[model samples]
Target: MSVLIKSSLARKIVMALSGLFLVFFLGQHFIINITSVIAPETFNLWSHFMGYNPLVQYALQPVLIAGVIIHFVMGFVLEIQNNKARGLSYVKYKGGANASWVSRNMIISGAVILAFLGLHFYDFWLPEIAYKYIENNPEDATRYHAETVHKFEAIWRTVLYIISFALLALHLLHGFASSFQTMGINNKYSSAIKTFTKIYAIAIPLGFIFIAIYHHLNPITH
Candidate 1:
């Protein structure tokens, strides 16, 4: 176990596994978030459950954070190691001929995605924490929908969210297929995997973007 941990392949394996975990999270999160547009009451109920459930709060939340941090840190490390090994940027490069733009620029997209996540935490997560822990706000699930609508009222915030989701789609387009490749799943089903990855990448992010836009435009008309 220690020997595997010391290997380069092991680091790649960890990054791939973490990336896959995040992919699963994205699907779940997108489904839950999109509920705001389709079914408000159900959305609130689920949001309350997620926020207040002891097991999710204590165990799953921490695991999710660790997975994200490990993936982010390992990605940066791998990029740095690869660059150092190359010793110089490619001259007369034709990487674009073989690889997609997202594949070639994984590190850049990953960095931007990380920045976008920070903004998300600032916009929603931090306030939630402060409300729950610091200000001692009531543990009321009914208020979540109103809070969500109010935040998207700002055009600029909505725009930033759309942009981030677009970039996230690009990031996932590469990441989903690449993680499978890293796990040695490249075989006759590779084409199918790529097809599924592309669809998921576009659909999930677009779903979130639509949610932001919908809330922003149709803000709780009473």
Candidate 2:
């Protein structure tokens, strides 16, 4: 079991599975956030429910952190190994002519998205979890749910979120298809699967962007 964990193929498999899990989690998050655009009151209610759910928070928080670390480390390790294996430098690219630009620059987009994640945590998660919940800021905690609505109402914050979501869409465009291939799902039907995945990759991120922009333009009354 230890050997398998250390093996390259095994690492890729684990990364792929964890990545897919994160993808699903992102979908859930995006859906929840979209509620703010539709009905701020409903969104505040839902956010409060999530914030107050100790069981859900305790169970998923650590799991999410672990999955993110594992997936990122595995991806970097694989990239390094591939680079070392190809000792010869190429002046021109031969393959990937048919691949989308996002497919080729997934690492770059992923890095950007990761940086945005840090900012996101700083802007929202830290206040919600660390300051409000951990330090027990009763005032902030009380307004936590409505705080999200106000945060998105800020034009600068909403613009930043829109940019981050755009990078996320690019990252997912390639990541969705590549994760399946890494998990050994590639076959004759792989093309169809990839096409569908790309469509979803586009839609979900656009949904988040639209909501962010909408909320920014139309401030919700708290």
Highest lDDT, which number? 1
lDDT, model 2, position 109: 78
lDDT of each: 0.86, 0.75
RMSD of 2: 3.8
TM-score of each: 0.92, 0.83
Q: Compose the digit string of candidate 1's lDDT tens values, residues 1-222.
A: 455336667778899999999999999998888889899998899999999998998999999999999999998887766566566533323475667667767888888889888988998889988988899988898978888898899999999889989988999988887788889896888999889988999999999999999999989755
Question: Which stretches in model 2 have alpha-carbon errors above 4 Å?
Answer: 1-6, 88-95, 98-100, 138-145, 186-192, 220-222
Model 2 is weakest, by summed lDDT over 10 consecutive residues, at: 87-96
Candidate 2 per-residue C-alpha lDDT over 126-173 given as tens digits, one digit per residue, 9 for 90 to 100: 877775557975542245445666778677778888888899888888
